[model samples]
Target: MDIFEDKVILVTGANRGIGRALVKALLNHGVRKIYATCRDLNTMPSLDDDRITVLSLDITNDEQITTVAVLAQDTEILINNAGVINAGNILEGDLEGMDNDMSVNYFGTIKMMRAFAPILKKNNPSKIINIVSIAAYSPLPSIAGYAASKAALFSATQSVRIELAKEGIAVYAINPGAIDTDMNKGSDWDMPDPESTAVKILEYVADGKFDIVPDEMGQGMYNAWREDPAKLSKIFSDLYYGEISE
Candidate 1:
Protein backbone atom coordinates (compact mmCIF):
# COMPACT_ATOMS: atom_id res chain seq x y z
CA MET A 1 0.00 0.00 0.00
CA ASP A 2 1.25 3.46 -0.86
CA ILE A 3 1.29 5.59 2.32
CA PHE A 4 2.52 8.78 0.68
CA GLU A 5 -0.81 10.28 -0.28
CA ASP A 6 -4.14 11.30 1.19
CA LYS A 7 -3.77 9.46 4.50
CA VAL A 8 -4.62 10.45 8.03
CA ILE A 9 -1.86 9.24 10.34
CA LEU A 10 -1.42 9.29 14.08
CA VAL A 11 2.07 9.14 15.60
CA THR A 12 2.93 8.59 19.23
CA GLY A 13 5.93 10.17 21.02
CA ALA A 14 5.93 12.88 18.38
CA ASN A 15 7.72 15.36 20.59
CA ARG A 16 11.20 14.23 19.55
CA GLY A 17 13.43 11.64 17.89
CA ILE A 18 12.15 9.24 15.21
CA GLY A 19 8.55 10.05 16.00
CA ARG A 20 9.21 13.73 15.49
CA ALA A 21 11.06 13.01 12.27
CA LEU A 22 8.17 10.88 10.99
CA VAL A 23 5.76 13.77 11.47
CA LYS A 24 7.87 15.89 9.15
CA ALA A 25 8.23 13.06 6.65
CA LEU A 26 4.48 12.52 6.49
CA LEU A 27 3.89 16.22 6.07
CA ASN A 28 6.34 16.32 3.18
CA HIS A 29 4.44 13.44 1.54
CA GLY A 30 1.27 15.56 1.59
CA VAL A 31 -0.67 13.32 3.89
CA ARG A 32 -4.14 14.71 4.69
CA LYS A 33 -3.51 15.11 8.41
CA ILE A 34 -1.41 13.87 11.31
CA TYR A 35 -2.37 13.45 14.92
CA ALA A 36 1.00 13.91 16.60
CA THR A 37 0.73 12.83 20.22
CA CYS A 38 3.07 13.04 23.19
CA ARG A 39 2.86 12.64 26.95
CA ASP A 40 2.71 16.35 27.46
CA LEU A 41 1.09 18.61 24.89
CA ASN A 42 3.23 21.57 25.92
CA THR A 43 6.44 19.66 25.37
CA MET A 44 5.43 18.73 21.83
CA PRO A 45 7.50 20.69 19.34
CA SER A 46 5.42 22.88 17.12
CA LEU A 47 5.22 21.77 13.53
CA ASP A 48 4.59 24.76 11.25
CA ASP A 49 2.15 22.78 9.14
CA ASP A 50 -1.53 23.25 9.83
CA ARG A 51 -2.17 19.62 8.80
CA ILE A 52 -0.46 18.43 11.98
CA THR A 53 -2.61 18.28 15.11
CA VAL A 54 -0.71 17.82 18.35
CA LEU A 55 -2.50 15.74 20.97
CA SER A 56 -1.61 14.62 24.45
CA LEU A 57 -1.48 10.86 24.76
CA ASP A 58 0.36 8.53 27.11
CA ILE A 59 -0.29 5.07 25.61
CA THR A 60 -0.02 3.41 29.00
CA ASN A 61 -3.16 5.27 30.00
CA ASP A 62 -6.22 3.48 28.66
CA GLU A 63 -8.50 6.49 29.03
CA GLN A 64 -6.22 8.68 26.98
CA ILE A 65 -5.95 6.05 24.28
CA THR A 66 -9.72 5.72 24.13
CA THR A 67 -10.13 9.45 23.97
CA VAL A 68 -7.62 9.83 21.18
CA ALA A 69 -9.16 6.95 19.28
CA VAL A 70 -12.47 8.77 19.32
CA LEU A 71 -10.83 12.03 18.35
CA ALA A 72 -8.86 10.51 15.51
CA GLN A 73 -11.62 8.25 14.21
CA ASP A 74 -10.68 8.99 10.63
CA THR A 75 -7.04 7.94 11.03
CA GLU A 76 -5.84 5.59 8.29
CA ILE A 77 -2.38 4.94 9.69
CA LEU A 78 -1.12 4.49 13.22
CA ILE A 79 2.57 4.74 14.12
CA ASN A 80 3.48 3.19 17.44
CA ASN A 81 6.85 4.87 18.11
CA ALA A 82 6.83 5.72 21.79
CA GLY A 83 9.52 3.84 23.74
CA VAL A 84 11.75 3.84 26.83
CA ILE A 85 14.96 2.16 27.98
CA ASN A 86 15.78 1.34 31.59
CA ALA A 87 19.41 0.86 32.62
CA GLY A 88 19.33 -2.62 34.03
CA ASN A 89 20.19 -6.26 33.38
CA ILE A 90 18.40 -9.52 34.09
CA LEU A 91 21.02 -10.54 36.66
CA GLU A 92 20.56 -7.48 38.84
CA GLY A 93 18.11 -5.17 37.10
CA ASP A 94 16.02 -2.89 39.28
CA LEU A 95 12.41 -4.00 39.65
CA GLU A 96 11.02 -0.55 38.85
CA GLY A 97 13.18 -0.31 35.77
CA MET A 98 11.92 -3.62 34.42
CA ASP A 99 8.33 -2.66 35.11
CA ASN A 100 8.77 0.73 33.47
CA ASP A 101 10.32 -0.82 30.41
CA MET A 102 7.55 -3.42 30.11
CA SER A 103 4.81 -0.91 30.71
CA VAL A 104 6.04 1.52 28.06
CA ASN A 105 7.53 -0.67 25.34
CA TYR A 106 5.37 -3.81 25.36
CA PHE A 107 2.06 -3.28 27.07
CA GLY A 108 1.80 0.34 26.05
CA THR A 109 2.16 -0.43 22.35
CA ILE A 110 -0.17 -3.43 22.46
CA LYS A 111 -2.74 -1.40 24.28
CA MET A 112 -2.50 1.23 21.60
CA MET A 113 -3.18 -1.46 18.98
CA ARG A 114 -6.13 -2.74 20.95
CA ALA A 115 -7.63 0.74 21.07
CA PHE A 116 -6.92 1.72 17.45
CA ALA A 117 -7.11 -1.54 15.50
CA PRO A 118 -10.89 -1.41 15.47
CA ILE A 119 -10.94 2.18 14.33
CA LEU A 120 -8.44 1.35 11.59
CA LYS A 121 -10.52 -1.64 10.52
CA LYS A 122 -13.53 0.59 10.23
CA ASN A 123 -11.52 2.81 7.91
CA ASN A 124 -10.67 -0.25 5.76
CA PRO A 125 -7.22 -0.75 4.21
CA SER A 126 -5.66 1.16 7.07
CA LYS A 127 -2.15 0.48 8.36
CA ILE A 128 -0.26 0.15 11.63
CA ILE A 129 3.48 0.62 12.09
CA ASN A 130 5.33 -0.42 15.22
CA ILE A 131 8.82 0.99 15.68
CA VAL A 132 10.65 -1.92 17.23
CA SER A 133 14.41 -2.48 17.54
CA ILE A 134 17.12 -4.97 16.57
CA ALA A 135 17.43 -5.72 20.27
CA ALA A 136 14.09 -7.47 19.96
CA TYR A 137 15.78 -10.21 17.93
CA SER A 138 18.60 -10.66 20.47
CA PRO A 139 18.99 -9.55 24.04
CA LEU A 140 21.24 -6.60 24.84
CA PRO A 141 22.64 -7.67 28.21
CA SER A 142 23.10 -4.13 29.49
CA ILE A 143 19.48 -3.11 28.88
CA ALA A 144 18.07 -6.57 29.52
CA GLY A 145 14.64 -5.42 30.63
CA TYR A 146 14.24 -3.06 27.66
CA ALA A 147 15.37 -5.74 25.23
CA ALA A 148 13.00 -8.24 26.79
CA SER A 149 10.11 -5.81 26.39
CA LYS A 150 10.95 -5.25 22.70
CA ALA A 151 11.20 -9.02 22.20
CA ALA A 152 7.72 -9.41 23.57
CA LEU A 153 6.57 -6.58 21.29
CA PHE A 154 8.12 -8.33 18.28
CA SER A 155 6.08 -11.45 19.02
CA ALA A 156 2.99 -9.36 19.53
CA THR A 157 3.59 -7.62 16.22
CA GLN A 158 3.62 -10.92 14.33
CA SER A 159 0.47 -12.12 16.02
CA VAL A 160 -1.29 -8.85 15.37
CA ARG A 161 -0.19 -8.89 11.75
CA ILE A 162 -1.95 -12.21 11.25
CA GLU A 163 -5.08 -11.21 13.12
CA LEU A 164 -5.39 -7.80 11.49
CA ALA A 165 -4.70 -9.01 7.96
CA LYS A 166 -8.20 -10.39 7.49
CA GLU A 167 -9.61 -6.97 8.35
CA GLY A 168 -7.65 -5.22 5.58
CA ILE A 169 -5.41 -3.39 8.07
CA ALA A 170 -1.75 -3.83 7.27
CA VAL A 171 0.58 -4.29 10.25
CA TYR A 172 4.21 -3.38 9.73
CA ALA A 173 7.04 -3.67 12.23
CA ILE A 174 10.09 -1.36 12.02
CA ASN A 175 13.20 -2.86 13.64
CA PRO A 176 15.56 0.07 13.80
CA GLY A 177 19.11 -0.35 15.06
CA ALA A 178 21.00 2.42 16.89
CA ILE A 179 19.26 5.69 15.91
CA ASP A 180 20.91 9.02 16.81
CA THR A 181 18.33 10.34 19.26
CA ASP A 182 18.23 11.55 22.82
CA MET A 183 17.23 8.00 23.67
CA ASN A 184 20.67 6.80 22.59
CA LYS A 185 22.66 9.73 23.95
CA GLY A 186 26.28 8.93 24.88
CA SER A 187 26.27 5.67 22.97
CA ASP A 188 29.78 4.60 21.98
CA TRP A 189 28.70 3.55 18.51
CA ASP A 190 27.89 6.02 15.75
CA MET A 191 24.20 6.01 14.90
CA PRO A 192 22.20 7.05 11.86
CA ASP A 193 20.36 10.36 11.92
CA PRO A 194 16.69 9.81 12.71
CA GLU A 195 15.58 12.21 9.94
CA SER A 196 17.39 10.33 7.20
CA THR A 197 16.39 7.08 8.80
CA ALA A 198 12.76 8.17 8.61
CA VAL A 199 13.20 9.04 4.96
CA LYS A 200 14.57 5.58 4.18
CA ILE A 201 11.80 3.90 6.17
CA LEU A 202 9.03 5.90 4.48
CA GLU A 203 10.46 5.41 1.00
CA TYR A 204 10.82 1.66 1.54
CA VAL A 205 7.36 1.37 3.06
CA ALA A 206 5.89 3.20 0.09
CA ASP A 207 7.32 0.39 -2.01
CA GLY A 208 5.63 -2.19 0.30
CA LYS A 209 8.64 -3.29 2.36
CA PHE A 210 6.91 -4.82 5.38
CA ASP A 211 9.63 -5.34 8.00
CA ILE A 212 11.88 -2.28 7.77
CA VAL A 213 15.33 -2.36 9.37
CA PRO A 214 16.64 0.95 7.97
CA ASP A 215 20.15 1.43 9.38
CA GLU A 216 23.31 -0.42 8.35
CA MET A 217 23.57 -2.27 11.64
CA GLY A 218 19.93 -3.28 11.50
CA GLN A 219 20.22 -4.59 7.93
CA GLY A 220 23.39 -6.52 8.78
CA MET A 221 21.81 -8.15 11.83
CA TYR A 222 18.69 -8.98 9.82
CA ASN A 223 20.83 -10.65 7.14
CA ALA A 224 22.59 -12.67 9.84
CA TRP A 225 19.27 -13.60 11.42
CA ARG A 226 17.96 -14.95 8.09
CA GLU A 227 20.88 -17.36 7.96
CA ASP A 228 20.92 -18.40 11.64
CA PRO A 229 19.13 -16.97 14.64
CA ALA A 230 22.02 -18.04 16.87
CA LYS A 231 24.31 -15.64 15.04
CA LEU A 232 22.19 -12.73 16.32
CA SER A 233 23.22 -13.34 19.91
CA LYS A 234 26.88 -13.23 18.98
CA ILE A 235 26.38 -10.20 16.71
CA PHE A 236 24.92 -8.15 19.54
CA SER A 237 27.32 -9.53 22.10
CA ASP A 238 30.24 -8.37 20.00
CA LEU A 239 28.64 -4.96 19.53
CA TYR A 240 28.41 -4.61 23.28
CA TYR A 241 32.11 -5.49 23.54
CA GLY A 242 31.26 -8.04 26.23
CA GLU A 243 30.49 -11.73 26.16
CA ILE A 244 27.04 -12.76 27.28
CA SER A 245 27.78 -14.14 30.76
CA GLU A 246 24.22 -15.29 31.21
Candidate 2:
Protein backbone atom coordinates (compact mmCIF):
# COMPACT_ATOMS: atom_id res chain seq x y z
CA MET A 1 0.00 0.00 0.00
CA ASP A 2 2.02 2.96 -1.26
CA ILE A 3 0.26 5.89 0.45
CA PHE A 4 1.42 8.68 -1.78
CA GLU A 5 0.82 6.90 -5.08
CA ASP A 6 -2.51 7.99 -6.53
CA LYS A 7 -3.74 9.08 -3.12
CA VAL A 8 -5.95 12.15 -2.69
CA ILE A 9 -3.96 14.12 -0.16
CA LEU A 10 -4.70 17.42 1.58
CA VAL A 11 -1.91 19.53 3.06
CA THR A 12 -2.39 22.60 5.24
CA GLY A 13 -0.02 25.58 5.17
CA ALA A 14 0.91 24.69 1.61
CA ASN A 15 2.10 28.15 0.71
CA ARG A 16 5.69 27.72 1.95
CA GLY A 17 8.18 25.85 4.09
CA ILE A 18 7.67 22.14 4.69
CA GLY A 19 4.07 22.29 3.52
CA ARG A 20 5.00 23.74 0.10
CA ALA A 21 7.89 21.34 -0.25
CA LEU A 22 5.61 18.43 0.63
CA VAL A 23 3.25 19.39 -2.18
CA LYS A 24 6.06 19.17 -4.74
CA ALA A 25 7.35 15.95 -3.23
CA LEU A 26 3.89 14.37 -3.36
CA LEU A 27 3.55 15.35 -6.99
CA ASN A 28 6.86 13.62 -7.76
CA HIS A 29 5.61 10.59 -5.81
CA GLY A 30 2.67 10.42 -8.28
CA VAL A 31 -0.26 11.43 -6.17
CA ARG A 32 -3.61 11.47 -8.01
CA LYS A 33 -4.68 14.74 -6.42
CA ILE A 34 -3.54 17.34 -3.90
CA TYR A 35 -5.58 19.94 -2.00
CA ALA A 36 -3.02 22.59 -1.06
CA THR A 37 -4.33 25.12 1.45
CA CYS A 38 -3.12 28.30 3.11
CA ARG A 39 -4.86 30.95 5.19
CA ASP A 40 -4.46 33.47 2.41
CA LEU A 41 -4.97 32.14 -1.13
CA ASN A 42 -2.88 34.99 -2.54
CA THR A 43 0.19 33.71 -0.71
CA MET A 44 -0.06 30.33 -2.46
CA PRO A 45 2.35 29.90 -5.33
CA SER A 46 1.07 29.08 -8.78
CA LEU A 47 1.82 25.37 -8.99
CA ASP A 48 1.40 24.27 -12.58
CA ASP A 49 -0.25 20.91 -12.04
CA ASP A 50 -3.72 19.78 -12.96
CA ARG A 51 -3.82 17.49 -9.93
CA ILE A 52 -3.29 20.44 -7.61
CA THR A 53 -6.18 22.41 -6.06
CA VAL A 54 -5.52 25.57 -4.13
CA LEU A 55 -7.91 26.56 -1.32
CA SER A 56 -8.15 29.15 1.41
CA LEU A 57 -8.02 27.63 4.89
CA ASP A 58 -7.33 29.09 8.27
CA ILE A 59 -7.36 26.02 10.50
CA THR A 60 -8.24 28.18 13.45
CA ASN A 61 -11.46 29.11 11.71
CA ASP A 62 -14.13 26.47 12.22
CA GLU A 63 -16.11 27.57 9.19
CA GLN A 64 -13.14 27.19 6.89
CA ILE A 65 -12.31 23.80 8.35
CA THR A 66 -15.85 22.57 7.73
CA THR A 67 -15.83 23.97 4.22
CA VAL A 68 -12.53 22.30 3.37
CA ALA A 69 -13.67 19.03 4.89
CA VAL A 70 -16.70 19.08 2.59
CA LEU A 71 -14.67 20.16 -0.46
CA ALA A 72 -11.94 17.58 0.12
CA GLN A 73 -14.27 14.76 1.08
CA ASP A 74 -12.19 12.27 -0.83
CA THR A 75 -8.95 13.04 0.98
CA GLU A 76 -7.12 9.86 1.95
CA ILE A 77 -4.21 11.54 3.69
CA LEU A 78 -4.46 14.65 5.84
CA ILE A 79 -1.24 16.54 6.56
CA ASN A 80 -1.52 19.12 9.36
CA ASN A 81 1.62 20.99 8.33
CA ALA A 82 0.47 24.52 9.09
CA GLY A 83 2.03 26.17 12.15
CA VAL A 84 3.26 29.45 13.64
CA ILE A 85 6.17 30.29 15.92
CA ASN A 86 6.16 33.45 18.00
CA ALA A 87 9.23 34.69 19.86
CA GLY A 88 8.12 34.46 23.45
CA ASN A 89 9.14 32.82 26.71
CA ILE A 90 7.48 32.20 30.07
CA LEU A 91 9.26 35.10 31.68
CA GLU A 92 9.03 38.60 30.21
CA GLY A 93 8.15 37.65 26.67
CA ASP A 94 5.41 38.79 24.33
CA LEU A 95 2.15 37.48 25.77
CA GLU A 96 0.35 38.11 22.52
CA GLY A 97 2.96 36.15 20.64
CA MET A 98 2.49 33.23 22.97
CA ASP A 99 -1.27 33.36 22.51
CA ASN A 100 -0.89 33.45 18.73
CA ASP A 101 1.45 30.51 18.78
CA MET A 102 -1.00 28.47 20.85
CA SER A 103 -3.89 29.48 18.62
CA VAL A 104 -2.16 28.49 15.39
CA ASN A 105 0.20 25.67 16.32
CA TYR A 106 -1.80 23.89 19.00
CA PHE A 107 -5.50 24.71 18.58
CA GLY A 108 -5.44 25.05 14.81
CA THR A 109 -3.85 21.65 14.26
CA ILE A 110 -6.24 20.07 16.71
CA LYS A 111 -9.23 21.52 14.93
CA MET A 112 -7.98 20.21 11.60
CA MET A 113 -7.52 16.74 13.02
CA ARG A 114 -11.00 16.75 14.52
CA ALA A 115 -12.62 17.89 11.29
CA PHE A 116 -10.72 15.36 9.17
CA ALA A 117 -11.03 12.36 11.45
CA PRO A 118 -14.47 11.41 10.17
CA ILE A 119 -13.43 11.96 6.59
CA LEU A 120 -10.35 9.83 7.08
CA LYS A 121 -12.49 7.12 8.67
CA LYS A 122 -14.76 7.10 5.63
CA ASN A 123 -11.68 6.61 3.43
CA ASN A 124 -10.08 3.96 5.72
CA PRO A 125 -6.38 3.00 5.83
CA SER A 126 -5.59 6.69 5.76
CA LYS A 127 -2.85 8.79 7.34
CA ILE A 128 -2.68 12.02 9.33
CA ILE A 129 0.74 13.63 9.52
CA ASN A 130 1.15 16.39 12.07
CA ILE A 131 4.24 18.55 11.61
CA VAL A 132 5.40 18.97 15.17
CA SER A 133 8.80 20.35 16.19
CA ILE A 134 11.89 18.98 17.93
CA ALA A 135 11.25 21.67 20.51
CA ALA A 136 8.22 19.68 21.61
CA TYR A 137 10.46 17.44 23.67
CA SER A 138 12.62 20.19 25.14
CA PRO A 139 11.58 23.80 25.42
CA LEU A 140 14.09 26.17 23.94
CA PRO A 141 13.85 29.19 26.22
CA SER A 142 14.22 31.55 23.28
CA ILE A 143 11.05 30.17 21.66
CA ALA A 144 9.37 28.96 24.80
CA GLY A 145 5.79 29.52 23.71
CA TYR A 146 6.35 27.84 20.35
CA ALA A 147 7.93 24.87 22.08
CA ALA A 148 5.09 24.69 24.56
CA SER A 149 2.49 24.71 21.82
CA LYS A 150 4.25 21.92 19.94
CA ALA A 151 4.52 19.97 23.17
CA ALA A 152 0.76 20.15 23.53
CA LEU A 153 0.32 19.00 19.96
CA PHE A 154 2.73 16.11 20.47
CA SER A 155 0.64 14.86 23.37
CA ALA A 156 -2.58 15.20 21.40
CA THR A 157 -1.11 13.30 18.45
CA GLN A 158 -0.22 10.41 20.70
CA SER A 159 -3.76 10.21 22.06
CA VAL A 160 -5.26 10.35 18.57
CA ARG A 161 -2.84 7.71 17.29
CA ILE A 162 -4.02 5.37 20.00
CA GLU A 163 -7.73 5.99 19.50
CA LEU A 164 -7.52 5.64 15.72
CA ALA A 165 -5.20 2.64 15.66
CA LYS A 166 -7.99 0.11 15.23
CA GLU A 167 -9.93 2.27 12.76
CA GLY A 168 -7.35 2.01 9.92
CA ILE A 169 -6.19 5.59 10.34
CA ALA A 170 -2.49 6.03 10.98
CA VAL A 171 -1.56 9.20 12.85
CA TYR A 172 2.04 10.27 12.55
CA ALA A 173 3.90 12.93 14.47
CA ILE A 174 6.78 14.52 12.56
CA ASN A 175 9.24 16.35 14.79
CA PRO A 176 11.63 18.24 12.56
CA GLY A 177 14.61 20.33 13.64
CA ALA A 178 16.01 23.48 12.06
CA ILE A 179 14.89 23.15 8.48
CA ASP A 180 16.10 26.07 6.33
CA THR A 181 12.86 27.93 5.64
CA ASP A 182 11.57 31.47 6.01
CA MET A 183 10.53 30.51 9.53
CA ASN A 184 14.08 29.71 10.58
CA LYS A 185 15.87 32.39 8.58
CA GLY A 186 16.63 34.23 11.83
CA SER A 187 18.74 31.33 13.03
CA ASP A 188 22.33 30.70 11.87
CA TRP A 189 22.41 26.92 12.18
CA ASP A 190 23.44 25.10 9.02
CA MET A 191 20.03 23.58 8.44
CA PRO A 192 18.83 21.19 5.80
CA ASP A 193 16.48 22.67 3.21
CA PRO A 194 12.75 21.97 3.42
CA GLU A 195 12.86 19.93 0.22
CA SER A 196 15.22 17.39 1.77
CA THR A 197 13.24 17.47 4.97
CA ALA A 198 10.01 16.79 3.10
CA VAL A 199 11.55 13.90 1.21
CA LYS A 200 12.84 12.34 4.43
CA ILE A 201 9.47 12.76 6.14
CA LEU A 202 7.55 11.15 3.28
CA GLU A 203 10.03 8.28 3.19
CA TYR A 204 9.49 7.71 6.88
CA VAL A 205 5.71 7.77 6.43
CA ALA A 206 5.94 5.16 3.69
CA ASP A 207 8.11 3.06 5.98
CA GLY A 208 5.19 2.88 8.48
CA LYS A 209 6.90 5.10 11.00
CA PHE A 210 4.54 6.58 13.59
CA ASP A 211 6.78 9.12 15.31
CA ILE A 212 9.52 10.54 13.12
CA VAL A 213 12.43 12.86 13.80
CA PRO A 214 12.95 13.75 10.16
CA ASP A 215 16.41 15.35 10.11
CA GLU A 216 19.92 14.78 11.44
CA MET A 217 19.61 17.39 14.17
CA GLY A 218 16.13 16.16 15.09
CA GLN A 219 17.33 12.56 15.20
CA GLY A 220 20.15 13.50 17.54
CA MET A 221 17.86 15.54 19.73
CA TYR A 222 15.29 12.74 19.82
CA ASN A 223 17.97 10.29 20.88
CA ALA A 224 19.06 12.63 23.63
CA TRP A 225 15.51 13.11 24.83
CA ARG A 226 14.90 9.38 24.82
CA GLU A 227 18.11 8.75 26.76
CA ASP A 228 17.56 11.54 29.28
CA PRO A 229 14.98 14.32 29.01
CA ALA A 230 16.72 16.41 31.66
CA LYS A 231 19.95 16.34 29.67
CA LEU A 232 18.18 17.57 26.54
CA SER A 233 16.58 20.40 28.52
CA LYS A 234 19.98 21.46 29.85
CA ILE A 235 21.41 21.47 26.33
CA PHE A 236 18.60 23.72 25.14
CA SER A 237 19.09 25.97 28.13
CA ASP A 238 22.77 26.28 27.33
CA LEU A 239 21.95 27.12 23.75
CA TYR A 240 19.58 29.81 24.98
CA TYR A 241 22.29 31.32 27.19
CA GLY A 242 24.93 31.28 24.41
CA GLU A 243 26.86 28.62 26.34
CA ILE A 244 26.43 26.34 23.33
CA SER A 245 26.04 26.96 19.59
CA GLU A 246 22.51 26.08 18.51
Best by TM-score: 2
Candidate 2 local distance difference test against the native: 0.93
Q: What residue runs in model 2 are displaced by over 4 Å at the alpha carbon? A: 243-246
lDDT for residue 176 in candidate 1, whole number 0-100 = 92
TM-score against native, each model: 0.95, 0.97
- Could you tell me how far off, in angstroms, the CA of residue 241 lies in candidate 1 after the best superposition? 4.7
The residue ranges of model 1 lying beyond 4 angstroms of the native Cα positions read: 241-246
User: How much is the lDDT of residue 5 in candidate 2?
Assistant: 89
Worst 10 residues of 1 by lDDT: 237-246
Candidate 2 lDDT, 40-131, residue by residue in tens: 99899999999999999999999999999999999999999999988766998899999999999999999998999999999998999999
Global CA lDDT computed for model 1: 0.90
Over 1-246, each residue of candidate 1 has an lDDT whose tens digit, in order, gives: 245588999999999999999998888887999999999888888689989888999999999999999999999999999999998778898989999999999999999999988899999888999999988988878888999999999999999999988999988889999899998998777789999999988987888878889999888888888889889888777756653442
**Candidate 2: clashing residue pairs, number:** 0
